[model samples]
Target: MKKRALLIIAGLFLLTSFPVTGGSAKVTQPPSQKEEIIYHIFQRSFFDSDGDGHGDLIGIRQKLDYLQQLGVTAILLTPLYESVYYHNYFATDFYKIDPRYGTMQDYLRLIKELHRRGMKFYMDMETQYVASDHIWFRDSYKNPQSRYSDYIIYTDKENTKPLQIVAGISDFKGYDGVTRKLVMVNLDNKEVQAYNYQLFKFWMDPNHDGKFDDGVDGFRLDHMMDNLDNLNRLPHLFTTFWNPLLGKLRNINPKIKIVAEQANWASFGMDYLKDTKIDRVFAFRLAFAIRNFNKAELIKVVDSTLIQTPKGKQQIVFIENHDMPRFSDAVKADPGKLKVGCALNLLIGGIPSIYYGQELGMQGSRQNFGITDANDIPDRQAFEWYKSDTGRGMAYWYKNGPWWQHNNNDVPNDGISLEEEQNNPQSLWNFYRTMIRLRKNNPVLIGGAYKNLINNNDHVFSFLRYEWGKKVLVAVNLSGDKQDVVIAMQSAKQIKNLYGIQPVISENNLAVSLPAYGVAVWAVK
Candidate 1:
């Protein structure tokens, strides 16, 4: 591990010639809720090191310059713990780093490097279930004499039949044949709770140092819900597990942020936020509405979500994530629509998170279930770092996997690679970088209150972000044709053009002619 770290640092020195947009300086203060712009990365698909065709922690450390260049203040990484699956959500061991992602030393170096660059790191935690190979499951399943016999929920005394829960109406039970059946943890047991608490604490202070600079800044709790297994088995989960656990974590680090991924995205996670005291939750309703181009629905959902959320709490605004198709693919890879989506995602009230490869407009849809072994591989394809499929840094580690056979490896030459788009002024990558810089420089856009502006045109969605006598107006045209719309705002002035069609403000009513899928943002005082 020490040798690997030395090699990674040497590689980073050779790449230091690349220009970084954001200055290199260690941040004295921790990132605030208002100033966070998170970029999510799937480690396996990001960049490879050791020529192993698998992305690792060292790879992420090497790309800190790229992320800093994009103007993101924080990074949300997928799970890095040991798991049999490629995604690593179902952890076999919570304390160990997956060998494919590199050693524990590599992870520590990555965290230290991120902090050195004034960036925050958040990790995804899926502690609800464990892989069949997990010690808790192995010992408890069909082994009454084992001390961990009560650690997992089982249907029979002999423990041959593990209790399965209804994931959804369509799926009666949840399990992957590769891992047999994932055993859901018995959170009711005191010993089980202790294990999870220790696991969380270890990641937060891996070296037992007083300072947490080498630890994660926050966590994204996956598939979090009030009811366990959707069967009301653990109805008091918030009271029993979450509140206490969060209280302990807060005692350790009060600034730690915990965001929940609601089991059902259709409904607001108000219960979890209020009861569990989670810091944030994903705005899935808005994401779905935006992807479908439901202009009215999008506006309505955004309004309700922002209005209903309690003060001091936050929503994680994103277009796509590891579990879903990329936003570009969702909109059929139309660059115009992708730009509009990015505009809304960044300009909204919540902290925006950009999924990896989103800025380059990478396109790949998840294959339909039952048709492929690993349906999600297409969506998690290697980042298009270069024009060629087998270029350096390409993580085609799953080339022998079934999903790779159906993967979208034929990305077009134009508008795909960072090397290509970084040079093109109007490319999607530039659009994201420019918009992010704008948001970072503007205080109103980052921490302001949201107000839905009245627009006569149904296809045009407009809003205002105002705070402390400062205001910014954002208008997005979701349609494929030009539209003239009047925005209702007082004392509005066009200060700058963030992206898309430039707006023209006249009096209290702002009138702008927007091209197809156009976006305009203005600083109004």
Candidate 2:
């Protein structure tokens, strides 16, 4: 509150002609509406501290200072439960931490360190399916009289054949080169729902002392859907299964936030917001639109996304994620397009998420390796921490394997590693840092409402973010050439450049010039 006057005064009298702001007016937004900048890390691909090639919890703790300096408010990690798979998605033991990732003490220490620095930890939880070795499946696979028989979905009346998971199959080869059996859980059963609630609650308050210092702040629900991949087995899940379980978890920790990944990427996820009332959802359509670099597409997607979002909820915007292709490969490693992507990722009206290696412009695309989950390994490669692959903390857990043959993404001396770009001022790493800092310093950019602008040129994508009396305008050129566009003001008569090249006023119109793939932010007067 004390710095509000100085900030407002600094924003005014900014080398332009506009009405002066005075009197007792002030700007503020609701606490719930304030968004978070999250850094999404693949647990096994982040960094390794024990020389085990696989990334561990201790590695993440060691890098907390680096992450804190990057200005992200939170970190979202993939599932950490014990599993036989490389990605650790299918849990063999739901209650134990994966040995490859470290021990329970390591996980607890990571949470404590994260909370100690005011950073939240959002654990990725997927309780829908388990591997063949899970206790529920092992005991009840062919034994109908077992007490846990109803815990898993069985095909025949005798409980001999279990229903398949996502791909409608009983088995899938894991990254460990083992074709392990899999089974979908009977989510409709009340017992299964109760188990899920308990699992979620355990992560929220591990020690259960009423203090969450050792627990996660929230959960990232993976592959959350109503019908479980539209297999029609668990119908009306949002109303019958999810709502009841989520309500109980919220009751325990009222401040806890849950982020759901809507199974259908093409969907606007309005139902997830309106029905389940989740805190945030991934903006998949906008991520596709950003990669296309089409101004009309960007305008339409951004407008449609914001309109569909219910009040008090937000959309998480990003160019790529664990399942998506790296943005560097999508743009052919073009620096300008990368900068434009960074600007929109942070400045858009939503909570922003940055994939682990995205800041360094690392490249990887999903490959079709015929069979198995090896195809997605390129998208989840080890974080490039040095100019060369052989480094102390390099978490190349998939190296010296058949899958590594296809991963030409991590070429040496390619200027993609953090070590290569850490000192370069014009690198993508610096651009991301600058954009994050700008978004943090400006309150309007965090909680302001988005309004698309109608510029003259089709290559220019412009929007206005306004809260209370403060307004900020962002314009990005999506083309490969220079562009000039005029923004007609309805109320404010002038615009002052705050983050990029300055613009001039021509008969009440704010005409701005931009370089190829240039982005600028202005303080509207």
Candidate 3:
């Protein structure tokens, strides 16, 4: 069945290619801002340089030009630490970079290259858990006399069974059905806290120099929640762990941004921001609302998030990430829907993050709901660089893996490879590139205050972005039918179309006919 699926998918890709257009648009240098456009990259699947079929720091360094061209001011990489799993979320060594990624020197060179190109780097860090092979866990598992015995949360004094917060949980298994024993760290342990702090500091400034040229600009704290294990194991994590750790890091580098992936996606991350003082939090609700095309819910979520979030704190809005299926896949690979998603993702008021290959309209989804190592392999497939399955930069390291064999339907010729899209102005990739350029060029769209516009039509979601005498009106048609809607924006001296058809403005009312999945953005004076 899987082989048949792969053949069908390949046949779909082999369809007549869209005629390539000549000439690419040149984008200007974006204005400097505290918040930036970030590109989230799964390093293992991004670009491989050593022909090892795995992406490395050197490969990322070589692609700095590509990132710069994409207008991403920063890049957020998944964990680079040694791990037993392919994702590297569970750390085996706190101090060492995964040999699959590169050595510490290679990391330093990548950081230096990013800095040279005026781009910042942020690494994902999940310090709550460690693989069974991790030295701390290995030493603490059976021996009570071991120095690291108190580092993890064990059910008993003898430390026989690691604390199972939820009974009979088997969600942490790897792709190969191998049960991954990831013991949660006891953050209350002072020694454990100290070790984590040092590990964070080492990555921030590896050389101990006051000049942080070779250091990371920030970290994305993964699975961060006030209560761990859902058993109230670590209830005061924010006060006891995050606050002090963030304080010390800010003392070391005030510009460092620490973003949290709130454990509970349903709730707004305001508590994490206000109490813990983290710089940013993922807007998971907004992301889901957008993905489902719930315009009413999306507007309400955006309004509440913007209105309720405290000052000086930012939200990182994204349609897809490492954990979820690609936006293109979610939207069934419709180019129109992809374009609509791109407009909302880039133009909406927040720090937008583009998942790698999102611009190319990549399609993939987890194959199984059961805890298996191969589940996420579909979502983490190699980036489609060219319009061919086999290409120069394709990272097909997982070709022989069970996950790849089971779910390898997504190929370069899916009509959305970067090479194919780069030459077509109407491609999703160009739409994203153009929208990003527009966002970077317009300060009002970047950091402006968001106001949900009153519109009678449910499918037409309109909003106003205004800041200090600059205002922009944005409306997106979420449905697949032409809709005529009247917006309540009166004071419009000049109007400029950013996407879709231009609007018709009259006294105190703005009317526009939007095609199915049409988007319109206007700079209103």
Candidate 4:
């Protein structure tokens, strides 16, 4: 079937580069640079070069080639600091990488390796609460006026309310057994306000001179929204905490990128934080829907989100993360749907994040506390890298990490491994690789203006991406039946390539017989 093509771009070329000249010749060339793409790594799946089960910083360093192969420019690692739990959200010490994951030297080696490959890294650090076992917490509990005294906000015993820890792996008693003194950060208390300011300084200031150092490149702020009740209050917190941190980090390295998880807020919040030195904020709502086969819903969410994000601030796109349901498990374990989602995320504006295991279609869910495992590791488990039936290395990188405990041990779930998928051209891993290529080749789709095409058919989603006189129309058949879409835009004239189906026009209406859950893309003539 002939698909209707929109007048996307006047010049449709794959990749543009200047021709080389003889060694003796001096020729001026345009600056060569590409936009950046950051990939998220779960601590468990990065590498197992030593035949260990756990993924350490050295493991990540070993797989830089794999990450570079996907054209990812940066890496955002979940917390690697000292902690009893797996995810390391409740940090025991921000400065120390848990011995299980590797050592500080390992992290330094990782940073050096990534930097050598022209890639950057961001560490997830929780600035709010420490683990119950944290020395600061222990010291504060023992003596109210101890060294860690100002770290926590102390409230009067009579007025303190019982607080329960629900999110992380372990629960700690809060204010229940306290009789004389109760402490909560009095953000309201101006005298103790420095406590909040000092928390950020702990990351930046090595000498405690209120100056940020060059030790780390960037920080991925966890639970950034917890301190403030509303969006308006973010700016003050940013100026006091984030802006200085960014400035300090930049002082050490100018190209550093700072990002945070607002958790709950409009995309416009990125704009508010931009002045505060935040480079990006993860687009949560948009990416969550893409984890499922909801094209129409994803389109709407992306459109609304981009509208709210401030200019120059990125809409960090992602499908799954440590906090959400594993992407593979959400789409009924369908690889096709996963590919389509990957295409959309890579092609959309702003930076794209590939949550760990998204490449292998890892499946997971939350039963009691919602998607969290028994170890309190957010449902994201250790990477399974066993050899496939073909004898390819499924996970040579995870030789040191422990295998994720499966809900059903009887099932033959170990058959699907990365090395196996790497050899299979039609596997989910290859599909993701292809989508990343499309995004890298087509710059217009990355930052282009999105015009969503709405029609009577709910299963078909069509949209136009126009930028710099270039146009590309993208349409996806989200359902099983063939859809006869009447082209509302008369300018759609010729056809390019359908993602997985042949486009044939019928009855003068660009009738394309799209396969079940198929996608079509037309490059404007």
Among all candidates shown, the one with the greatest TM-score: 2
- Pairs of colliding residues, candidate 3: 174-372, 174-373, 175-373, 175-374
TM-score of each: 0.90, 0.93, 0.91, 0.77
Candidate 4 residue 342 C-alpha distance from true site, Å: 1.9
Q: Which portions of model 3 show Cα errors greater than 4 Å? A: 1-35, 165-172, 406-412
Query: By TM-score, how accurate is candidate 2?
Result: 0.93
**Looking at candidate 2, what is the lDDT of residue 426?**
93
lDDT of 3 by residue, 262-295 (tens): 9888988988888896989999999888988876
Model 3 error, position 461 (Å): 0.9
In candidate 2, stretches whose alpha carbon ends up further than 4 angstroms from where it belongs are 1-35, 491-494
- Displacement of the residue 401 alpha carbon in candidate 2, Å: 1.9
Model 1 scores a C-alpha lDDT of 0.78
lDDT (tens digit, per residue) of candidate 2 on 111-159? 9999888899999988889989899988997799988899998989788
lDDT of candidate 4 at residue 268, scale 0 to 100: 40
lDDT of 4: 0.58
Writing each residue's lDDT as its tens digit, candidate 4 over 146-176 gives 6665565443333223122324223432212
How many clashes does the backbone of model 4 have? 30
Lowest summed lDDT across 10 adjacent residues in model 1 is found at: 10-19
